[model samples]
Target: MVEETIKLAYGEYSDLIKDKRIAAVQALSGTGACRLFADFQKRFSPNSHIYIPVPTWSNHHNIWRDANVPQRTFHYYHPDTKDLDFASLMDDVKFSQNAPKGSFFLLHACAHNPTGVDPTEEQWKEMSYQFKVKGHFAFFDMAYQWFASGDPEKDVKSIGIFLEDGHLIGCS
Candidate 1:
């Protein structure tokens, strides 16, 4: 009952997709998605804390807080640079020595809200490597998938790179 071209394109794209080891859940909105994961994080890993970006959505803090999970902040936005503070972020992850090993880190997949800044491909790769070394889990909030670049596939490059680096990601 829909347009023929849209259906055809959907089929073609669906065919191109191979099953990757990713788990997902359906939620009403970004808030719902975050709340769901916060619940899961609290339920399963109660002792662990969630590391959120410096300037993420306001609800991110509330969701985990309501879930009774303690929160930690990491360096993400550089007010002067108006971009990602990769070195500072890495230092927090690598040298902070406060965050426990194997903690959950909330990552904005692309088009980070409020700032709209994202890391470069190379930056993502290095972050993935550092995450691997530190054994941190990357939980992605991809609410604005194609909203940044107007191309969904290009947007997925970040997640794909993380997956390629063997990171166990949680996405909704």
Candidate 2:
């Protein structure tokens, strides 16, 4: 399957992803891609950790664990308000020392699966800057790109922020 077509059809930053700098590979599913990435992470950044939101795809934990990659948790959803929990998320990110280098962070591009909440543009920009400072890698999963807002551009805004900041990204 042609990823470029998929990107263009969804209108989710197809041009940027199509740039010669990116390297794309085929996967049977998101879980498969995550598993492959987990294995790759183990090989390339053996000491690096994979930071996932407190609540993400349940399969995420299994994929990384089965791949032999050490897993770490970061703040995301607020138990009380059931919202973005931006402050706690930032606090966790700011205080995270484990993301020293070569660390991978999993981000939901849009329509957060379970929470159905996403960070604002301002929040995304802040996180992008923070990640830049920490030298961390971002892995975005855009499965629900158009399902949330019915507009792909709005859905993938976070990823665009990273690209604008000159960050290399991997997505599935």
Candidate 3:
């Protein structure tokens, strides 16, 4: 089940899958997965902080807090337009008075909670490029895998983009 799940998210032909580079474990649920990752992040990157987007799932805050991981907020939703605050988000991602290089970010893989807005493929590519340039780490919350496009394969395009850019990512 774990292997199959990894293939579903990372693509069946992914070299990471074939090379056994992914470390995965089954969790009770999406919240469980997120909490486990938070714990792992706190344990491994003790001094690092997690950058979460504003207007995300409320549980995100609680989970990270319980894990004792420091939290930082980045722009995400624009209340006026009811859409993504792309410019501000980019500014944060680029570390403009926000997180530093090698910072960890929590990204919604698709069907972002509450807002239901997902970045376009081009935006994902740009984000991946910036992440590479800034040495940022992406921790994807893929709880709504097929909810964005109604196709699991297509919904995971963001992750694929990061992978294509040679990023070692974490997904839940």
Candidate 4:
């Protein structure tokens, strides 16, 4: 089961591994995936912190915090606008520049819970570039891939963007 999961998780992109540039793991689901990553991060990089989106799934904060990973929040949802605060989010990504570079960032791949807001493809492209420039690790939780368009892969467009930029990402 473990090997199958790993293969399924990474096999689609054989090109990535042939280049000796990718590592990955299998997770049970969204919560399990987040916990596994949190544990790995805490074990290897005790001083590092994980950034969570404001108004994210309630379990996300608990998952990381329980694993002893320091938690930080980047501006995400805008209550007034009922949508993504793009400018603030960009600033938050830039703020990671001052953080201990190479920190972890948790991103909802699609159907962001509670708000149902997602970045347009162009925004995701910019975000992928920002993660590249900032050297931040992106942890994608594609818990609801069917939410955006009733097509799983279509909802994963954001993850595709990150992959195109060669970001080392973990997904369930």
For each candidate in the order shown, give its overall lDDT on alpha carbons: 0.79, 0.80, 0.92, 0.81
Question: How would you encode candidate 1's per-residue C-alpha lDDT over 13-119 as one tens digit per residue?
Answer: 34223342334445767788789998999999989999999999888988889999999999999999888998889887786475667988999988998799999
Worst 10 residues of 1 by lDDT: 1-10
Could you tell me every candidate's TM-score relative to the true structure? 0.86, 0.90, 0.97, 0.86
Error of 4 at 1 (Å): 6.1
Residue-by-residue lDDT tens digits, candidate 3, 32-142: 999999999999999999999998999999999999999999999999999999889999999646979999999999999979998899999999999999999999999
lDDT of 3: 0.92
Please list the residue runs of candidate 2 whose C-alpha ends up more than 4 Å from where it truly belongs after superposition.
9-19
Expressed as tens digits, the lDDT of each residue in 1-172 for candidate 4 is 7555444445556576677665555567668877998898898878888888888999998898899998988888999999999899889888745444687888898989878999999999998898888888888877887678887657778877888787878776
- Estimate the lDDT of model 2: 0.80
Best TM-score among the predictions, by candidate number: 3
Task: Name the candidate that leads on lDDT.
Answer: 3
Tens-digit lDDT track for model 2 on 6-61? 56433445565556456668887778877878887889888878899989989889
RMSD in order of candidates = 4.4, 2.1, 1.0, 2.6
